[model samples]
Target: MRVAVYYPWVYLRSGIERALIEIKRRSRHEIRIYTNHFDPRGTFPELDGMGVTELSRVSVERTYSAVTAAALSIVRTRLDPAEHDAVLVCCDGLGPLLTFANRRKPVVNLCFTPLRATYDEVYRDRLLARGGPARPVKRAAETVFRLVDRMAWRNFDEVICIADTVRRRVADNRLFPESKIHLAYPGVEPRLAVPEGASEPMFLLPGRIMWTKNIELAIDGFRRFLRDAPPALQRFRLHIAGMVDAKSRPYFAQLQELAGGDERIVFETVVSDERMRALYTQAWAVLAPAFNEDFGLTPVEAMAHGRPVLACNRGGLRETVLDGVTGLLVEPEPAAFAAGLRRIAQDADLARQLGAQGPARAAAFTWPRFVQTIDAVLDGAQRRSV
Candidate 1:
């Protein structure tokens, strides 16, 4: 099937980009993508080779900020069923537009938590969350955006979230019935996540330094874990690696104060993917304590490398990480995370066992499986269009 997938914008080689690459690789269907901006060097280099059309000439800053690009993409990347057999609206800020532009027809929504900034109530509380200094202005903008989103959401014939937890959230939205929403789990490229020999006692927290990511929890938990841990477990260290810039520096400093100059707690401001893989390969376990995460990719990616993960039990982590199997799940609190830290640190056998089971569990969430689910969905949509 020939599908015109709407991505709207690309800023980084994030989970969505990775999913798109995997889909492009595994699917037999012809996919001509639409986006406002495309920078292969900054984002996925593979995107340069893909059948992607640059929808608009947007500035670099505007491309990264969804508040700036949302209206532009909505007004510009408007899709019609006549242009393609089916449409897959899988990108940020593009969902409302694609569904709105499709003339109330069947449009597929591959959601990653329903536009957190626009829909999330907590977003309006802070400036960094909104990406600017205009609170009242942004709220007014989101009010209009919400109206458009609701209208667009009603047009979606089918909706797919990356996990069952997210599927439930989308189902509860009331715009679409539960039956219309489905679960199409995201997968990791395990080959790139090549595991090393027996790992050292190191806990790696890999993600953005945003408040939502809760990097402070990792530092606090690790500090508490070491206060009463066995001598053998003392070798364990916590390494935080991801994009850290001027915006993140303040949050990063807060985490530093929480660490209290502990050598065990580490943060790398300029860590590359290769460095992250190295950390993944050598680490005892991956830690993701993000509260209410939609579908965490870090835990799955860590599991793909045969590394055990100690993640929060909330949100998609519950589905992605098989508790007491691939890894241990804990509540999103300091004590729970500290307890998990202690358990993984002290019990080498249990850690190894969890690590051994991780790859097999992660294998089920492969790119082929993800692509197959979407293919079936899009194929059905195409048939319905006919």
Candidate 2:
């Protein structure tokens, strides 16, 4: 099958890229990716040879760039199943909006979610609350985007949500029947190498420094954990590492203030991949306190490296981290998170037990499985069209 893929951005590493790479390698399909921008050096260089076309006409900026591009992309490009047998949208946002090119072809959307700006109530409210006249203006703009997104989604032949949480969201729309939606849980590359010796009890939380990440809650829980921890655990450190931007600086500052000169609470704004693996190897467990992540990759990465993950018992985390087995899941509340942290700090044997199971659990989620799931959806979509 000849597949035309549409990914909205080529900025960062995520589960989408991992899945796409496997799709290209394993699927018996010719592929071409359409997008507004793609930097081979910045993203994976392998994408350059994958027939990615950057629509220079679609300008990418900080805000409204993706929604704008999505609308423009469908208007500019013309697609036919004769030219391309399937349309694969491997994007979280905007790409679903490109289904306007469906034209009776099988449109299989690798939907992580609808455009988050339009669909995510919390993200929309937080992002638009600037004050007075500007707030209303932002709200109006988002409303238009949401309308466009809902309209475009109607054209999708199939929507594959990467998690059950996302699948449920699509089901709630009822705009499309549940039959068109599916769960294609993303998988990870396995790398199990348990550390040689017991390192200090360190908790690693990694993601973009955004309010959406709920980094503050992680910090709050870490502070609480430190207060009552034993002398040995007192030396334990909480490492917060990820990319940061100007808009996120204020939140980073608030986290620093929350720390209150606690030397054990370390903030690493950026780290090389080598450093990240090193941290994961030596850390006690990956801390994922994101309030309700659609699907988090940090915990998976931690587990792939044979370390346990302590995450909130919400969203996709619950699906991956089996409570009291592979990892412990706690409520989003700081007290609950702190208690979970404290449990691990005090119980070294429990930590080791969880860590020991991490690799095998992560192994079950393989790239082959991810690709096969997606291929099955594509086959179904094609068969339905016939």
Candidate 3:
């Protein structure tokens, strides 16, 4: 089969690249990616090591322009009546897919979420209240998305959601055949062996310190957890590793102020992947309290390290974190999160058991499995066209 995968955003770019690489290596299919956005400055070439072929490189000085160009190209090419075995669009925001609704090729859309609901439920207010043209722009953008989403869903041959929660939401929308919708989780690299002496009570939370991450809640929980923790456990530390952009400066300042007079909370921004991996290895668990993550990669990385993850029970977190088995999932409330933290702190054996289960569970989500899952869908699409 010949597969063309379109990725409009840089973030989703890596995941598509990984799956393509796996398909190229293991599946008897020719896979190529088409993109007008080249982040030569970014680490996108990192996927080259994994073996995905880049069919075309489109350069753009700005993010939005690149996305628009990509979408337009999809409609022009895919709708030209020139058929392909399969066409995979990485996310719902790609508008060009709607234009190609009646194309002869099989269209597989990776539906991460309904864009309008994503803004209304997760990001709009918090971002809007922050005061910027960004908020209103998002509002207008979401309105446009509602129309795009409906067309993309009805037009595509199949819609793939990353989690069951997202699938259920789309199912309720009832725009397409239920049989055409599929659940396809993100793939992660295989787990590494747990490092010796990894049972120490350190916590790793990596991701940008943005409002969506709910970093405020994590900080509050950690501070309160320390307040009543036993003397020995007081030494336990949290190392937050990630970038702190100018937009997040105010929130970052508040986090720093909250940790005042407490030396256990360490904030390191723009850390390297190796440094981030080291933090994951040394920690007893990874803390990801994000409120509206579509699908988080941090907790998966933690699982890859054979470390347990403590995340809020919402969005993709619930799908990723196996409560009582892989890691503890708590509500968004600080007290609830703090209690879970304390529970693991006091029960070393239980923490260890959960920690040990993580790597094995992480094993089932390798790049190979992700590629295979996608290949099966593409093959089925090809057969039906016959």
Which parts of model 1 have CA positions greater than 4 angstroms off?
58-69, 79-83, 91-94, 102-106, 118-142, 190-196, 245-249, 269-274
What Cα-based lDDT does every candidate model obtain? 0.75, 0.74, 0.68
Q: Which stretches of candidate 2 lie over 4 Å from their true place?
A: 44-51, 57-70, 73-75, 79-83, 102-104, 122-134, 190-199, 245-250, 253-261
As for candidate 2, its clashing pairs are none
lDDT of 3 by residue, 1-386 (tens): 77766654343223344444455566667756555443433433455454333323443322456655655654554323353467776664553354354356777776666552333355546655664866666567666656665766676766677767667666766655666677767656654534334556787788777667888788889888998998988978888888765456888898888778577888998666677777887888889998767777677777778788899998888877899998999999999989988988888888888888887777755666666677787788778878
Per-residue lDDT of candidate 2, residues 100-200 (tens digit): 65556878778777656656665566666644567876777777866777787777777788887777766775545777677777766544433334555
Report how far residue 96 has shifted in candidate 1, in Å: 2.1
Clashes counted in candidate 1 amount to: 0
- Give the per-residue lDDT digits (tens) of candidate 1, residues 1-386: 76777776665657788787877788888888777667776666788888778766555442337545656556555655566767778844445565655653456888877766654443335433556666567667677867777877877767777887666766665656777777788887646444556798789899777677877787888888998887877878998888654455777788888888888888876666778878889889999988778788888888888899999888778888999998999987899899999988888899998988888788777777788888888777767866
Predicted structure 2, TM vs. truth: 0.87
lDDT for predicted candidate 1 compared with the true structure: 0.75
